[model samples]
Target: MKADVMPKPQNMFQAYMLLFLISSGQIGVGIFGFQRIVGMHSDHDAWISVIVAGIVSHIVVGLMFWILSKHESADLYGIHQHLFGRWIGNGLSMVMMVYYVMVSVTIVRTYIELIQSWIFPTFPTWVLSMTLLLLAWYGITGGIRLIAGLSTISFFVILFFIGTLYISPIKYASWSHLLPIGETSPWAIMKGTISMGLTISGFESIFYIYPYIKDKSNGAKYAQYSLLFSNIIYLFMMIMGIVYFSKGQLTRSIWASTSMLKIVKFPFLERLEYIASSVWMFVVIPGLMIYIWVLGRGFKRMMGWKQRMMTPIICFVIFIGSLISQDREHIHMLSTFTGRCALFVVFLYPVVLFLFQTLILGIRDQSDKKGAAE
Candidate 1:
């Protein structure tokens, strides 16, 4: 199965780091305006969609660990090979590599778009792209341990920024806007659940990071906590968005989370959204670092390429791609495509794997018992 090609286990991350890493990954780009998109279909009942999606995410995380628990030391590539044989498995792994790369690109570019639209209309895209990519490049080269530490930083820093919502957005909210909930049809709520699925897709990073956990048995628990935390944050933000903006205003605002900052005027400070925007870089950086690192790690696993070399090249490609995709429409298309792809990769794929593994084990156990009886 070419398992020997996988790097020898080195120092591993602790259980807590799993919480930080998974949370950091899931909480990015999507959280800002996820309410609007999900709301478009489900409307005020969108928070219901968030809750349902969170439950689904918890289930998916459990299934991921079920699969990983069966093959304790293997990553997704190894699991694929075990289930599908060498050629098909490697091909699937290749596709995952491409998905990871696209994730990194979409995230970095979207953040860049946010910057250009909100804070710096005249700023050159390439400059911001290059600068962010360089920082990500440096972090990825330090390997997963450094990346985990970065996630820890992102988690705490983001909390303070999240606290800002309490100051302004909550005051503007009308709880009546969220009333008449459950008024949406089941089909509509399910559609919103699907949208929330995309927003919460980053938990799939666990597939790549699983083998590195120091306490493998506790891995699933920490992952569930991470997903739980993300769900809470997402739900809170979506509710705030619903109440603060009228139905029309909520749907129209692209970055509703940041838009909440406009009401956050202080005696000494003005343009609080700008302050929130600046702090968002911290929130965004961890996701970019982890996804980019995953892309590099995927290359290392499949082709035996050095992650150090692969990272900068991937970053360069993302930079050039960002430069080319300055149009808002183009950026939106990229995000939509990535979101759809992630729904399959992150949510559905693991369930299929877990079922296949369970069936195979059952059949093998029957054969063994029959042989022993003979």
Candidate 2:
């Protein structure tokens, strides 16, 4: 931790705890919809795009940590002030505030959509929203420690889903279908990588968790590696998605993962997807809670509140926003726009911070050396 950074909530998580929170934030509902998006473009090459996108995000997230690791402690808001003057930093901070809110709202809508599609149709949307909001408020109010504890459990469940792919042999996977990487062009693949990158977008929450880590000195190392873990896990999922979906079968399907499971049969279990997807809340719940917690943290920072004053207000706002989902198209539009906005903070913000910090440090070092020589 940098000398300048203050421990907020006056307590920090162990390295392992921090790692769990970051990874949980990375893993989410993306896995469920991933195969559908991957099948839209190239065949097996979807896996290639997955690797490419993961590498790109990995590099960008590394730069994010490099900028934060330079100062004793700088939240995104603090980094804005460090790089930009007060006015510009203030402006950028507001942009981040909007980004976090949009993210949480979009996720809230998605959660509702999933519940309506899979579990509950007759349940009033408001009732589902309120229940989710209640559960999230409890977790977010407890702070990062609770988030980490929940994530550790979710991580194990998510791993079992990834491992389930192993039960079906890849020898059945057809290669003639996957032979052509780019029947169209490299441009198409790039476009797919950019679009489907949403599946892996959860890694950005490290910005919120940096100050919460017990060891700041090696926090970047831990973050980068945790992201690395996320990348590899995601990559494996993509490969399994491609191989499992096949080529022709994927072309005609709506949700490739759902359709792919149509072949799965056992004496005891008829629909593996039903049972499998039931545990899926493991991924969705923790993911929604994390973004909500980050939203709460932002409120806490801006309001300058005692613990008592801050959390309730934050939870109330999130609960209210959960009612914003009128339909699927609306939620999709919100998610799409928010994801595009996230690109600025995720991809562009760190580069700007790195350049500004480097330039300022160089100037300060020169001034120090000149003064000593005089």
Top lDDT prediction, candidate number: 1
Q: Number of the top candidate by TM-score?
A: 1
Across 84-192, the per-residue lDDT of candidate 2 in tens digits comes to 6567776877787767666666666676666577666776877766776678777766777887889988878867776774456354565565566657466666766
Q: How many angstroms is residue 283 displaced in model 2 relative to the true structure, after the best TM-score fit?
A: 1.8
TM-score of predicted structure 2: 0.87
Stretches off by above 4 angstroms in model 1 are 1-10, 361-374
Q: How many residue pairs clash in each candidate?
A: 0, 5
Worst 10 residues of 2 by lDDT: 1-10
- Model 2, position 158, has a per-residue lDDT of 67
Task: State the displacement of the C-alpha of residue 15, model 1, in Å, after optimal TM-score superposition.
Answer: 0.8
> What Cα-based lDDT does every candidate model obtain?
0.83, 0.69
Candidate 1 TM-score to native:
0.94
